[model samples]
Target: MAKSPYPVINPGGGPMGKVIIALVLIAIVTLVIKYPSDAARWVHGLGSVIDGLVDFFRTLFG
Candidate 1:
């Protein structure tokens, strides 16, 4: 018997995975298009929070 050249690590979740991914991509695009400013502010706030945490850690250690 011959073995498959490309083995199937995950045999199932083929079409379903594609569909879920497509839906998620569509949602993200729609959000970016509809709420451009809101999205930008949200991302900026996230960056600020991360920077504050880094500063706090540096002050604590050094």
Candidate 2:
């Protein structure tokens, strides 16, 4: 079987990592859903950081 390019992330894996990722994703999604403008500004403010993260995921999954 081929290994996944992304980390072997078990959604229900270790409690702490799961919780943190869940909360971060929730916060991002909530911000986007509730306040699109603010979300855009926040992402802009953290421009490089956000870009790096996006790139990281794309690389991991691509």
- Choose the strongest candidate by TM-score: 1
Can you tell me which runs of candidate 2 are displaced by over 4 Å?
Answer: 1-13, 48-62
Candidate-wise lDDT, in order: 0.88, 0.89
Global fold similarity of model 1 (TM-score): 0.56
TM-score, every prediction: 0.56, 0.48
Worst 10 residues of 1 by lDDT: 8-17
Among all windows of ten consecutive residues in candidate 2, which has the lowest summed lDDT? 7-16
Clashes of 2: 0
> What tens digits encode model 2's per-residue C-alpha lDDT throughout 18-51?
7898899999899899999998888788998888
lDDT of 1 at 13: 62
Question: Model 1 clash pairs?
Answer: none
